[model samples]
Target chain A: MMPAALSEATPLLSVRDLTVRFRSGRETVTAIDRVSFDVPRGRVLGLVGESGSGKSVTALALMRLLSPDMAEIAGEVRFDGRDLVALPEGEMRRVRGRHLSMIFQEPMTSLNPIASIGNQICEPLRLHLGLGRKAARDRAAELLAMVAIPEPRRRLDQYPHELSGGMRQRVVIAMAIACEPRLIIADEPTTALDVTTQAQILDLLRDLQSRLGMAIVMITHDLGVVAEFADHVQVMYAGRGVERAAVRDVFGHPRHPYTGGLLRCIPDFDGDQDRLVGIDGTVPSLTNLPPGCAYAPRCERAQDDCRIVVPDLEAVAPAHRAACFHPLEFAREVSP
Target chain B: MLNYIARRLIYIPLSLLLVLCAAFVVLRATGNPIDIFLDPNHTPEQADVLTARLHLDQPILVQFVIYLRDVLRGDFGDSLQFGGPAMPAVLDRLGATLELLAAALGVALVLGIFGGIACAVWRDRTPDFLISTIAIAAQSMPSFWLGILLIQIFAVDLRWLPTSGRGDGWHLILPAATLAAFVLPNFVLITRTSMLEVMGEPFVVTGKAKGLSAAKLLFTHVFPNALNPILSFLGIQVGRLVAGSIVTETIFSWPGIGRLLIGSIFQRDVPIVLAGVVVVSLFIILANLIVDLLLSINDPRIRLG
Candidate 1:
């Protein structure tokens, strides 16, 4: 990661201590607990986590799409000096799709099968921009072309099922950027695609982000994705952020034990003649999380103090933070 | 596509065979049409002459074969009661009957879909509750009884519409409304349940994340996905509506196939009765084919890869 002086710019969006809990039967399950992060303008923030790590929850909370009956949320989401959580629903709705939009993981069902691609893309334009039908449709075609779909004009009449999976995902991306939002939160955008298609989509996103200069929050469980594109990385575990810093620092230093364990889980073809390693145990059940440090039972260096007290996210060095009792100094202690 | 059409084509003859077999067995088992044809009190000479002339003296198998052969050649025989060829009379009445059926179904479909949408969108609210309760009540009530009540209110008391007969265009209203009511509830329940379920699917969630407003989400995303059930239910409902038209048509004195069927039943017009049954069955089979074609047009997943 580049030094702070070279990258200094006011962050575009800021999130703090965001917690979401759902009540089921007689128990309250905390899904996202005290997760905080920032999205610098024109930069990519990768939120890497395993399933049930609250990465999706954090992204959804950004748009206030949580089921009203099931989940209760508490957090400060400051976007351009405004508290998004405090915004009225009508205002929030206007802000959504126009200012903050998302590209969902699965393009298959995300699209309306009956509607022509034109109508689906032009929907937000008509709603938010108040564009008339003709203008909206024209813009929809333009967006299709912008997404590199061939024969944009003719494709407008076609239904979603007419297109392949990769094309549909591109159509979804076209819709996501239809309003030219400042932040595009793509939630595992390639999770449902083949590897070759995944690579193509990732390239498209990076190219679009570079050209358009929108802040992107790339949420994924794939460390490889973060390593490739993310300017900054935040590793979340048990509904909270365990490590956050410049991408290189987090991977090169990897202060937290859980972070190190997760990194080891990703297969390294560049080194090691052996088979891939793995982290033990599934994600802890949200309904019955352990006290203090949620990852303590799984941590290799955990001791009596680590078990008793949950460590706070503290700065171990400039612009690098971790929630661990002992930071790994393997690189510093061992000569290259 | 050709394979599908071929399979469907084979069912046509296969269906006709089943109908002919049923007609033969049921007509024979109920009462010998010959015995009914000749009065028992008739003199022996008269009965013998009638039996020999009509080929009643022939074996049952021979009679069935001859009857099946004539039917295949489009000769439905003469109506015993009407004193004319049964084919022309049956075909003429079929046109008017089908017209009424089509009109009634149209009314039912438009109302049912709109009502279902209202209920699904409003769900558990007053409009939804009112529409559902009314539809269910209308469904549960006998169409014949409901038609009688309608005649009593709108025809006899209020004198708003014609009371009976297909004398004027106004006469079709009461019978059509009654039939529409009968078909309404099934479509209402099916469409509403399907729409609600589709609304809960993950795609709808993804749609919301894309910032589509509530209205677009309902009409475009939710309603279209909900169309499959409605299409499937259409075939069954049309079949039932045509079959159930009998009592309602009789009650309202509507000049439809159902009324013709009843009149033929008392006259012991065997050819006319068989024609009526065949006509109704054919319509049902055709409606199912139309529904299939519609499904293919609406959903790509149904096609063989």
Candidate 2:
């Protein structure tokens, strides 16, 4: 509808102040507190966070998948020039699977056990694309082949339990990409898989992203995955975004102490170390988070100001941002 | 699939043999049928003649062996009360019982499944509260009391249906409704619970994310997975319903196996009672087997196993 130049300049997904609060009895706990980011067209944005850091909640909110009875979401999620936050449910559903899709963590439980893989893959094609039964089946077979599943035709009639874990995940990916969505939200897609399978899946996702030019929001707790796959990185702590920058900048010039702690937690295979370094404390409970920065309690750099007031996510470098008053000044090189 | 069915079919006769042995021992332990069957003024010589003729005078083990041989030959001996073969009499009443059972099952499944799905879909809302309250109340009410109440309302005052005695479809209304009322609650509760659980499964979320309509998600995904537990429960309910029909049959005066079994027990008609036990037990066993088969077909995991 608009001029082509402005549309080309705009990111594929632009999220601003996305907040999610879950209600239990009388108390309300904010799971995602005013987090924001942008994913440029065809780029991969890594959302790194520990458990309870609101990564999954943010993903579900973006998709409008969270149950309204349990969660209250407020924010702007502008995707492809449409206001997704304010879209009606019926309209949102149309956006889902057709233009925006999601790949879940546990492929074991993601697919319907009773349904054939073919039918599962065919569902979205038939739903959004309006493909007939025979057409859907043919498209489904092509999709299975695209995901690198062996014997795609025979595998179509196979149930979930008949397939191995890796194959099932491939089938799930096949389903996710069936309609050739413009964006895919992969929430820890490889966490449940073995190391070899994880690499294969990442490779497949990377290959698919470039070939299809679909923006990807890769949500995970693994920094290694970010280093390997993401072009940009956003680090979250206690339901808030603490750092946002390009993958190379965030890794080389680690700004937030929490982000540094995460990078250090990964075992150094070349170095002489007896044990792996872990962040000292657990993520604070959402209902009882500190008034100041939620990570201040666990941060070694905490000061009087850090305990008294929260710091806003401000630019540290040209594009790098971190929400910390005492961010590291010097850049430390870390090769991917 | 055929191999699985064959394996199950092979168990039927072995299970029936075990039932027959238990029945023979328990029936003999109830005391000789001669004492209850013979007239009080009958001569001692006449009683002795009857006992020997019926094989009651022989050792229990010898009588059991003779009984097994006769049963293997499809001869259940004569019903002392009916003065006919007990098997035929029991079989004759089976059709009526099966008819009542089918009607009652139809009523229960239709109302119960729909009610359960409603309760689940509208869970924690006014409709769920209302349906759950009604289901609990219905479950608690005895079948006989319900039958009597239905008779009072529909037959006595309203004059819409016959009060008792099985005849045409009109006579079936009250008894079948009563029997169904007792079981319908179980179906509602089970289906609701199963549906709730299945609706929470990850595949359901996947279905939702696929932008499938709510009804499509429910019918194609949730209901199918939920069906396994409901089917298993249905198998168990069939056994209970067959036994439960005794009270309903007696109240409604429906000439079913339950009524026949009740009359035989009261009159100490050993042959008829034994025949009824074997037939009912066999029916329950077969119903359970069919349910297991259905479950295997419905779930691939179970099928492959």
Off by over 4 Å in 2: A1-5, A330-336, B43-52, B56-59
lDDT (C-alpha, whole model) for all candidates:
0.85, 0.92
Q: Which digits, one per residue and each the tens of the lDDT, describe model 1 over residues B178-210?
A: 889899988888889999999888678767876
Q: What lDDT tens digits, residue by residue, belong to model 1 across residues A136-161?
A: 99999999998889999999888888
**Lowest-lDDT window of 10 residues in candidate 2 chain B?**
B31-40
Best by TM-score: 2
lDDT score for residue A38 of model 2: 97
- What is the lDDT for A131 in model 2? 99
Q: How much is B172 displaced in model 1, in angstroms?
A: 5.8
lDDT of 2 at B200: 92
How well is each residue in B38-98 modelled by candidate 2, as lDDT tens digits?
A: 8788898989888888787788779889999998887887898889999999999999999
